[model samples]
Target: MSWSDRQSPIVAVATAPGRGAVGIVRVSGRGVAPLAQALTGRTLLPRVATYGPFLDADGQAIDHGLALYFPGPHSYTGEDVLELQGHGGPVVLQLLVARCLTAAAAPDAATGRPVLPGLRLAQPGEFTERAFLNDKIDLAQAEAIADLIDASTEAAARSATRSLGGAFSHEVNALRDGLIHLRMLVEATLDFPEEEIDFLEKANARGKLDGLQAALQGVMRQARQGALLREGLQVVLAGQPNAGKSSLLNALAGAELAIVTPIAGTTRDKVSETIQIEGVPLKVIDTAGLRADHETSDEVERIGMARSWEAIGQADAVLFLHDLSRMAEPAYAAADAEIAQRLGEALAGASTVIHVFNKADAVATEAVATHLAAPPAPAGQAVALSARTGEGLDSLRQRLLDMAGWQHQTEGLFMARQRHVQALGEAAEHLALAQAHAAQQDGALDLLAEELRLSHDALGRITGAFSADDLLGEIFSRFCIGK
Candidate 1:
């Protein structure tokens, strides 16, 4: 939206659309006190909730509720804000919103002019976007607001709350401060060309750079974990028909989510479920059993197989299941080998693969042990588990966590998006170049200063100290209407 558009008084139903005990209609802008008085038919005490009726233009009660007024420079968006809490029936909320617009546009009895001019409906995320623009919150904190609302797990919600509370912004600002200090030192050395090396050495420029890099690494590690929490791992289960893929999924989820049967093509589609391990969400998918084209003459089964490969290509990891009981069958072994070869080719090292030998309870212990010792595919970790009996599931879960790089360290860790991770990575790259320049015998002060400046900017983007308008729009646009 344009700058002036954002400046217009905006109103929206702040509560979600549904029938509930209460709903809220929020209005924010300059000179909103007059509008509040017009709506409530009395002056509202600033920052105090007054129980009353929300009146219509005809001077009649539309709804009995609570009204709160917050004056400019002291409210959420740094603008005057008026909130009306009423019954949460969808129709009632709509009427209240319409009433707000009507009240804002009506002529004032005192001046015969609009009570609040330029009143309009708020766009999606406009409320929170205004908070960011007004300095009430930084970019990361603003993002965290949406993250907290959409969090899928308790851990994710807590981390998002921390970020919204400025935990992430605090760290980014600290790094920026360090970078600024180092830049000042390097730039000063650039001015004194003759004594550049001596000045840098005396100021301990290399030592400062080393300290900043170490701190950056620490933040990067935590940020990666936070990102993992936000975007959970996608795990797809693959194997020949009826190789216990469905059973394994059901066991891991602790519920019957997919159909398990002895039929080779019982599952002709993808079945997905999100299971949390140590607060980390893993979306496990059971796909149609992988098999040779000639083995499945049915068109539906062939289509399912095609989709299975497509999912594998997009998965973060693949579980290639092997039937332990069928290992003695020559045809079964050859088919398993063919499927393994196709998996390696399809994944091409893009996704991690875990060798899972299933149905151990149905086979001899020695056979299971021998197969585990020498997995058909020696590419990744192998686990011999009986899905029907729930054996060895814990080991598989731990291996998945290890592959995801989760360290089980949650204290002080804030929620982060993929973009935050990328920005930190870029900053680290710039710092590495700066370090290389500082290590030279006759270090180039100007080059070092430029690298530090670039790194500083990269970090600034995280907290919005340096950000593009388009970036801000993109980030806020994802939020639901009414924030």
Candidate 2:
């Protein structure tokens, strides 16, 4: 929806859609206090939780709950807000929401004030969108609210919290302010053509642009790390049948999530688990055995093998497991070579391939040394581990983290989306063009000014100062209702 369109009061069940000990039905926008009183039959003091029975159309009690009223200009969404904390039954919570809509529609007999006609069910992320439009929070901070709720790891949660508290936006705003200062100087020099060159040179505009470029690079590095935490690596376990793929899956998950057996082609399907390394989530997918198409004529095994190849194709990283015990067998070695060639072709330059040698306990140290010393894979990593004994698992875990490019502690990180990273890159590109224009002995003043304006516009997009209507809609549409 357009930002200029007037908004009406909105209501929804803010809690998860299930039974719990307690649930919340929230209302926000104009006449929230009056609506609260209409349902409660008592004046609700601002910012206080008043306990009472919520009445229906016939003054019959619908439910007992706590009614909290937050008056306008100080509440969430920068409007009057009310929350009804009630029992956690799905029907009970929905009934409370129905009561809110009904009350918002009813007119007072004495003052002839009709309930807000616009009061209705809230759309997904509408509340937060209202907050952004009302100046209660900026666009980045609004996105953080959803990010904080959807965080899959402790590090992600902490980083999202930092962004919600304005860490990311603060950095962007500071850079924007510095850029604005430089733009003012450049544009001001254009008005007087005589001293323009000497004026820009004397002002050291190039030096200031260099400093700004350095600062942008620093923020970009942190943002890249934060993006990794939000969108973690998808690592798939691929190898021949009975190659200890399931055992490695269990070891990484710290549980027997997949069945382990000695039977060839035991795992005729894919089993997945999510594990974390240094608070970065890794979705580990253990696929069935990879073999020649005709060798396993069993219909199920053939399908499983095809799926394994499919998973390898889309993976962010592939952990190609090898059984060390079979490294010396001539037939086994030939099959291994065939699989490696297929992997090289399928993955190409798209994914990182890590060579993991499993069943270390079954082979001697000298044998492992001779095996690994042969040749390295094309890319990614190579490590040896005993999934049964849990040896070298630490090395594997750290290797996955390195592949994901995760760094820094929670306190030093802030959550960022891919869009934010792309925006930063666009701004950097514009700034570089501006720098080139400024460096010329007799540069066109108009071109230099235009480049600076473009850079400023790019930076402002992050904070909603120069955002488009469709972009805002796309962003808020991802959030769940009543956010």
**Candidate number of the best TM-score:** 1
Q: lDDT scores for all predictions?
A: 0.91, 0.86
Backbone clash pairs for candidate 2 read none
Please provide TM-scores, in order, for all candidate models, with all chains considered together. Answer: 0.97, 0.96
Off by over 4 Å in 1: 192-197
**Model 1 over residues 1-483: C-alpha lDDT tens digits?**
798998999999998878999999899999999988888889999999999999998889999999999997899998999999999999999999998898888899999999999999998899898998999999999999999998888999999999999999999999999999898777876776686358557878889989999999999999999998889999999999989999999999999999988888899999999999887889999999988888878999999999999999999999999998899999999998898888889889999999999998998899987887785657458888889999999989999999999998777789999999999999999999999998888777778899999999999999998999999889988988888
The sequence of per-residue lDDT tens digits that candidate 2 reaches over residues 312-373 is 99999999888999988887778888898999999987998888899999999998777666
Give the best candidate by lDDT: 1
Clash count (model 1, backbone only): 0
- How does model 2 score by TM-score? 0.96
